[model samples]
Target chain A: MRDIVCEILSNKEVGENIFEMVLLADRVDDIQGGQFVNIQLPNKEMLLRRPFCLCDFDEVNKTFTICYAVVGEGTKVLSGLAVGQQLKATLPLGNGFLLSGKYNKIMLIGGGMGSAVLPAIARRNKDVECVCYLGFANKGKVVLEEKLREVCSKVVVATDDGSYGESGFVTNIAKADLDSLGVDAIFCCGPEVMYRAIKKTFADVNIPIFVSLEQRMGCGIGACLVCNCKIEREGKQGYYRVCKDGPVFELKEVVL
Target chain B: MQRRTSIRVERGGIVSNLKVNIAGVEFKNPIITASGTFGFGREFNNFYPLSDLGGICTKGLTLMPRDGNPAPRIAETKSGIINSVGLQNPGIEHYLATDDKWLAEQDTVVIANIAGASLDDYIAMGEKINESNAQMVELNISCPNVKAGGMAFGVLPASVEQVTRAVKNVCKKPVITKLSPNVSCIADNAKAAQNGGADGISLINTLSAMAVNYKTRKPILFNNNGGLSGACVKPVALKMVWDCYNAVDIPIIGLGGITSYTDVLEFMICGARAVQVGTYNFTEPMGASQIAKDLENYVKEQDMDINDLVGSLILNK
Candidate 1:
């Protein structure tokens, strides 16, 4: 990965607490859908860099977008970053989600802000048919629904209080459609609680579930062993560097 | 912004003296990546060449492979970070079998940072290191995460001497005892290492600290506590290095929160022959190498020998 100074093209809130930040910088020659970029906040009070998944990228304009929520001190600083400001960024980090085949239909599931990782999947595999399932707390919390619709073949948005597209959980709808959809693969990004729900709901279904993990990270490049994820690769069960070894893994392999 | 690739590259009748001799090992420069911060150098080599660094200390290696502590091992605070990774490493045998050959070819000095459960483990690993390609051995007896050895030996002066003498007796390469900052008397420990025949000494390791979550009223780190490092610790490190400089005759390799060329210079003026860049590497992908570059520029611009800066600080009486 290369470190370069990126100029903020735009920074605006897209959802209740979520924001979409666009940057103008050198063209990222190699960007996989699930890969991420680590942006350093220009403040001295916050020393660690903030990592974001690639929400959208334009190769021609050498621009990339990161969709973030003001969750902590760092992101609050990121949200306040004005247009035309410069920030140091290291791009195209982590092993992106490995699609099984080039030509295969896939099911993508996102929970709340996890929807930010969905559009990239469909963006990369344009040839493959992508049906998406998104779950949000309510209409106010929903994000990236339209962005997913622009890339995927179908988009099903669900809210807990029935304030949006459909009522109940999105997983239930995806589970019902799984039998007939005959999708070749499934990819998910969400909280551990949601992963538990998916694991219990899809245990009988035999499709390989791919997941992107989120962890507090350091070095973004994997030297510092702070961001560790447990997974059983081969027969050995061990902790892997989430920054280097993953951020993406086979659902069954992820110990958590 | 241009990088001077060699140690003594002369231009306009100016000889860039970025070279440093620590414990009889000649480093092309004074920039070494701190152990446990920079892994085997494979991941970072993708950004820059390994030869750009003057030295590398491998992740702390134990006799047997360790799974390390549970997740939430790190928490970032203001201007620094606290971590309790517990030295999760591939074991010394794995390194010698797999990573040793590759590290040897990196065209820079490799200092093996080894920790252990007991004195026997330290001596055994030291003896075993002779069979590898490492240029020096850095005894990591200051890790705060583990329960048995590490920090236990680093706190008191007598045990520090014993551990150093034990490793020095068996290890063929020069032995540098890495000191912990959490001790009550850092200079005494430096003198202890010197008394035990240590080739050199490096200080200070991360200080013991914690980060708490007020909402849950619990600790942020899974280990409850960890060692803190970053720019915040530089002042503490400089003072400790100066204290140790007055206490011992052995070469000093200073560390703790080193981020820039001036920080490197401060360590040298306080009597460090060389310095290691730690938490800053996590800040900048090319941090350690970049610091070496910035230092080279300053050295060339001044046309001065870097050695003259060692212990050059003047105090008001």
Candidate 2:
């Protein structure tokens, strides 16, 4: 990964503390879904590097986008980056979702900020019909609903509070759709509860379901065993690294 | 502000070799970026070639996938940091199937750090890593801030012994058990690991700590508590290393808030054959390699052999 001094082409507020920023990168080759770039925030006072999952990538335009919620000082600084200001990043790191000849139909489920990985997954697998199930707290906190609708065959939105699309969690609506559409596979990136709920819903379904696990990654790459999660297969269980082994895995494989 | 010199200093018409050997296995150098700090050596390669380092201890891998804890997981304190990431990860099979190819190609010792909630969990995960190109298994028995069988197994010397014995039973390669600093007696724990037939031991994982946001009247981290790291915890970690050094004869890999060559020297003097850079990598991108260079220079400047510095400062009580 090359550290390029990127100029913020545009910064748009997507939700609370969440901003979508388009960066002009000279080095944008091999960028894909589930892959993330490490950004070096301004003012060296903030020591650690902040990582944001790639929301979308455009090679012809020499630009890629990142949608992140400013949860800390590092992100707050990134959100304040002006259109002309220079930002540094270690681009195209971590193994992304494998889209190679596996399934015909895929259900992309995202919750809150995890919706960041959806657009890229949809665009790359245009041949496969993508059904999206997005969960939000309320209508006011929703993001990328319209954009997702354009790419996916069917876009299902669910809010905890009955202020939008479906009045329950995205998994409930997804379970209802499974009888008719019967998704061949599932791709998810969201809160733990949402994923856990989805895991139970698809417990009996003999289909491949992948989910992206999140952690406070010290290094966006894998070196530290800091991000460890428990797993079980055929009566045996152990730990897995979210950064290296995943951030993507089949849901059935998860013990959660 | 002046930029720090990242250029490699030359010596004797040769690029200095920083390779390290532990229990017959050769690491390119003694400088291994610790688990949870470097990721899989892939991301660091984006900024700098990962092959330059001696080795990498991958983030902990389990049998099944886990979503980990909620957000607000990390909280930076005065001189250290506290985190409750809750070991978020995809399952081990996924890693072996997907990331193994990329991991094998790297010219570094890929040490798979394995963690589990139970004995069965440890054995299963160790078996998976044994099937891969992973050079060794760094059994992570020191994750102090997590619930659900993680920190509990690490805190007790008996459990440490059991887990080490269990993992060593399944793993084909060397098993280095990473110990928790949160324990009351780290030496006893180290002895427990040694008795359990651990090939080597890595010290001072993380100290249990926390920080509260006064304005919000809540803990800064989402988990309400976290493991502290960075320069601030160096002394505590050093103490643990010193204690473990005196208690056990096994090779010690010292860690916790190592930021400079001075800190590395301190650990070496305390009987660490090698050092793992943890939170320091987050502070400086090339902190580990830079420290390695500094150690080499310091050795040459002091007109001393590299081995001479090992255990040179024991207080013979």
Candidate 3:
């Protein structure tokens, strides 16, 4: 595959350690939500793929956006990327979130940069009545609040430090909202801690829960073993490649 | 500009079928992405079409799930990286449930790399793999940082024999035991795997290495330790592959920082039946396919037959 350099539409800090990068890629087609784009870092020495959920897509504008955190050298370059700068990229990779029309009341939950993928999921199932719960460390780390509000029927923000919105884990807020509003399905993406917390609290929720996993990937494709996630079903257990099967998985299907 | 000379000058000629049949298994090409390098086959496919390459060796999976080591699990030194990912997989069960369908659809071969913290862990996971559609199972006994099993089992010949035997009991699939480089005798370890009934062997997983941060005066990786790989380790890996080649009769899959067809030829000349592409994947996104194409041209130019060069490298008397 030939690597093409696309112009950066904008790169700005949206929240704490979180950045939003808009790129002008006319060749991008059939891009999906869970699919990610790989960007070359400012430093060529660190040559590993940084996987980011496709945040939003624009066919008319021929632009796509990705939300990421400043976790490593790749993100450092991604954060510093300037408008109009050309970036080498491979776009719209991996199986995206599965969309089904069977469900109606939807709950979109995100913690930290996990919230990056929420809007795309919401956009995918716009016909459903959607509610969103977003968690962050504090107000400084909060992002996309207004944008999420535009898509969902209701939006709730939770911060651990109590700098903004409710002061507690977002899962707690989600539980309260779900009890009152009653959702048919729950979709979430966030850190391992938050995912675990949500998984445990929602154990009795009785809804089809979906979680987006975060793993360090090498090829961004299934060639490397670094991002293998284990799964067990019907008395059988085996390894699943996160880069392929999911960055988004049904909560019951995932081990953690 | 004049084209550079090709890497294959041997009897095998350029690998037209780049696709090869090893131990009754089929691979699209001889070039395979090593374990821990190409996550599951999906990540890289987003960059390049996987049909271009031969196979993929997934990251090491264990019996029970693991969170892996603390932060700073990776560090870069010169042309290589030292990583202590600590076998951070979601256990064997999680992998099969989620990714089985996607894997069965791929054109390339899929080999599952199994790691363990104990003998039971190895056997239990091996049993699970034997039931799946995985073409082969790579026993990763070479990781250095972990305390319970990893490098400890890899270094001692007796432990290697014991673990290999344990895994062999349940795993009916072709078992490829990945040997560690930090051991005193690479040949001895190769012999150990052969004695334990391993169908094949993979030489030189990763060398235990460390790097220091100048500013903080601490280790570069958060784990304070990691495995070294890349261009620098190819020579060492090739030498070990040659030594192991002479020591064992079974096939050997060679890996460690192979970015070019020349490196593939060196490993083949030294006695590797097949080769795995490692760190180069991080640098060149489509390195495996590029090497596959480059080697094909090299094979065509060499005009040598395949059998003549397959494990046919001669040593000075």
Candidate 4:
């Protein structure tokens, strides 16, 4: 809701082509888990702002963290910034997860860089017992496990190559214990295929499941109708703005 | 050039007069938020006041509510974006019931931009919007005419005149024909709208463009082709606006990739009485308002009335 100049506190590579950056900013008290900040890249060539989810926030330090993968030229430019550099960002954008609901056991699933937002979600819902399932392409791609463990009650990691943690997709691990774990709620963020797989795996469970989506954004705000996703409404399908209506939505509410 | 010693200052000490009159409709300023980019003017109101700009063109409304295209509706190109939103809007009835009151209460002028697949659809929408509180109706001829087998109405002068004349006959409010840039002859299209009794003309609705995902060997946008808009298209838009200006006598509302006050001046110099800020709204939510303020300062610096800049470009032939 406000544009602020954030000073980079630290920027370092946490994994292959992945980075973790902490920024010192003011007025971050309202920023919750699952919400994102649109960071204006310092490069003049790139006009559009990049949206990154809030990996974590420190109210006491007046700082926030964003974990991004260098998938494009914008992030490549972002990776070149030093600790003392400054960047303008629009913060606390889009609706975050509905964390106020009463739940004793929560299952959080993240795939690849999608795992970035899970730490913040776990941190905010400290009252609930949080179990995190993180999937990576391989052991070399794994990240944020220790960060998730700081706030989550349990952190489970999966890799396709079996080089780390368990030898399979995160859905495989979740499928085995999802019903038996007494999970009261579920939240996920990953590729479209992964979301589809998770939705099917937990179809029988009558609990609220939330998923965060990524789309090619224009304004990162709701003004541009570019980042639209189909959702079910009144027994029919309708379109929702991912930037405003959600980057996060109840699994059943979206068609996926 | 001699520097004038006297500086005329308005009530607020800004010498620039931003007010503009187009087709007998008065605007507080010349910066109108482009259609489709501004939505219902409610979303950006969260960042800045709607009253800050001269006008707001509502999202393209159709006869019936449309769900729009499928996922991956947008793709980013060099300094621009391709979008196939397909005029996803609540039908005109929904607008009159929901957004009309809110729009009427605003200090800004409300121009309803409408689209349809046929001439009847255009007339029906125009008639409905004319009965509402909107000050003007912008006929979106850029939309593909499903009845005409997908060819857009704005691509040809004959169809452009046909649709404009039909809608202008039934609509009570001033009609501004929004022309597409995908045509071979933009000037002819502008003249066609004028000949059909359009009160004003808004040009260069997104250029027909495409992008592909090389790995998948498929188009990035679900619709395969989309309209391109942003900084990348500004130069082409400026040229088209100039072309349209020379071809018609009606006031021109130039748009396409307008970002800053300078771009606004460029359009005005090319004979646009007013300009619309489109894709830039996505990058800076308060861009129109910011440009309006900057324009006041710019005119003051030049020691000239804002109107003096309109159609001032001296082409060396």
**In terms of DockQ, which candidate is stronger, 2 or 4?**
4
For model 1, which pairs clash? Answer: none
lDDT of each: 0.89, 0.77, 0.78, 0.87
Per-residue lDDT, model 3, residue A161, is: 91
Worst 10 residues of 1 chain A by lDDT: A95-104
Chain A of candidate 1 scores what in TM-score?
0.96
Give model 1's DockQ, 2 decimals: 0.73
1 or 2, which is superior by DockQ?
1
Backbone clash count for every predicted candidate, in the order shown: 0, 36, 47, 0
Best model number under lDDT: 1
Q: What are the runs in model 3 whose C-alpha is more than 4 Å off?
A: A1-7, A26-29, A38-42, A84-95, A153-182, A192-206, A222-225, A228-241, A250-256, B1-179, B187-202, B209-228, B238-253, B265-274, B279-285, B297-317
Task: Look at candidate 3 and tell me the lDDT of residue A104.
Answer: 80
Better of 1 and 4 by lDDT: 1
Candidate 3 global Cα RMSD = 7.3
How do the residues A1-256 of candidate 4 rate in per-residue lDDT, one tens digit apiece?
8777899999999999899999999867787778999998887557788999999988899999999999988999999999899998888888888675678888999999999989888887778889999999998899999999899878889998999999898987987978778888899999989978977887787888889988878777787677888889779888898889999998887886
Error of 4 at B78 (Å): 1.2
lDDT of 3 by residue, B279-306 (tens): 8887667778889888888777765433
Predicted complex 4: CAPRI docking category: medium
lDDT of 1 by residue, A1-256 (tens): 7898999999999889889999987986478878999988999767788899987787789888899889988888889989999999998899987563754899999988888888877887677889999999899889888888898888999998999989998888889988788798899988888888898999997878988998888788888888988999888899998888988898999887
Off by over 4 Å in 4: B1-15
Model 4 lDDT per residue over B1-317, tens place = 22122344433344556788998999988999999888898878878888989999999999899888876888878888889987888888999899989988989999999999998899898788877899998989987788999888998999999999999999999999999988889999999999999999998899899999889999999999999899999999899989988888899999988889999999999989999998888777678889988987887777666666677789999
List, residue by residue over A12-80, the lDDT tens digit for candidate 3: 887777888888886655776567776666565565656678788777888878888897566787787
